[model samples]
Target: MLTLFHSPGACSMGIVFLLEELGVDYTLAAIDLRKGEQNDTAFRQMNPKGKVPTLILDDGTALTEFPAIAYWLCRRHGAAELWPDTIDGQARVLELVEFLVASIHMRGFTFLAMPQKFSADPAAQDSLRALGRREVEAGLATVAAQHGAALCARSRIGIEDAALFYILVWARALGIAVPAPLSAYAEALLARPSAQVALRGLAAG
Candidate 1:
């Protein structure tokens, strides 16, 4: 069985949705970030970075980071519907994934939610967060411009959409305002059955 260590409403929510969409058997382990369970010694051993969404494979190997876990699940279960097929399709998926991870996902969460790590000076931290917010907005705009419409019309969920959906959710939870297009995109994603299950689970937790 696969075990996913996740926090409510974190980017890990996307992983949860993906698992359900693929109809794969897995176990969900909630990490209470509010109580700093992510920083606990046992959790640190699972993810030294103290991040959520760590995947423990059936063989007891742990996987950190979203892109790897998402892709691995898609491949392992032969769920090609959640992943692209051709070379160009795969490249586009990766391009979107990297942009979200670098500009919006990591940068957004770090500067906004954990500013103390970047700087001790209050003014400096605010300045960095302001810049990070702008970058996140720009990154979302770029994603919407490039692929939003195509994804909305697609018949099935794919890795790019899953990644983008979770990033938007995390942004909202951190009180980062997203533009209208991205908000619409998120609404569409959340309306899916798999996402509904993930949302209910998050709410219940």
Candidate 2:
């Protein structure tokens, strides 16, 4: 069986949602980031980067990074609905995934949540967090303006939606204001059965 290494409330939750949506059987391994479990030797052996959402395949190979894992699952499990069918559609999904992960999650939330990593001075840490907040807001605004309408019209959950939902959770935690339409979009995603199952799975893990 496949095993997914994840941290509660992390971007790995997005991968959990994808796995649940695909109806795949997988085991969950919770990594406690708060206690510095990610820095442990055992975890580092699995993923040198020491990141969550690491997938250990049945063949004993490890796969890290959310987008790559999502794509691998979709292709291996024949879940084409999770992604687009056409070239342009596929490109758009990839684009959104990259933006959400890199620009929003990495540049914004990661910085905001762990500003001390960026600087040694106390005042500098606060400044870094403030900058992260602005980046998050700008990134969210871009998402809302570009994809809010399309997301509202989606009848089935897609990979991009899973990624976006994770970001929305971070946005809420950071007290970033979401536009009304995107907030509704997020609500719709949360209401999905797959999403519900993912939440329960995360809680259990």
TM-score of each: 0.88, 0.92
Candidate 1, 1-205: lDDT as tens digits? 9999988787888888888888889998999888989999998987898987899998887899888888888878746566667889888888888888876777766676667778999999888788777777777778778777776667777766568768877766667666666677788787788877676555431
lDDT of 1 at 38: 93
TM-score: which candidate is best?
2
After superposition, the stretches of candidate 1 with alpha carbons farther than 4 Å from their true spots are: 174-181, 201-205
In model 1, the worst 10-residue window by lDDT is 196-205
lDDT of each: 0.79, 0.84
Q: Per model, how many backbone clashes are there?
A: 0, 0
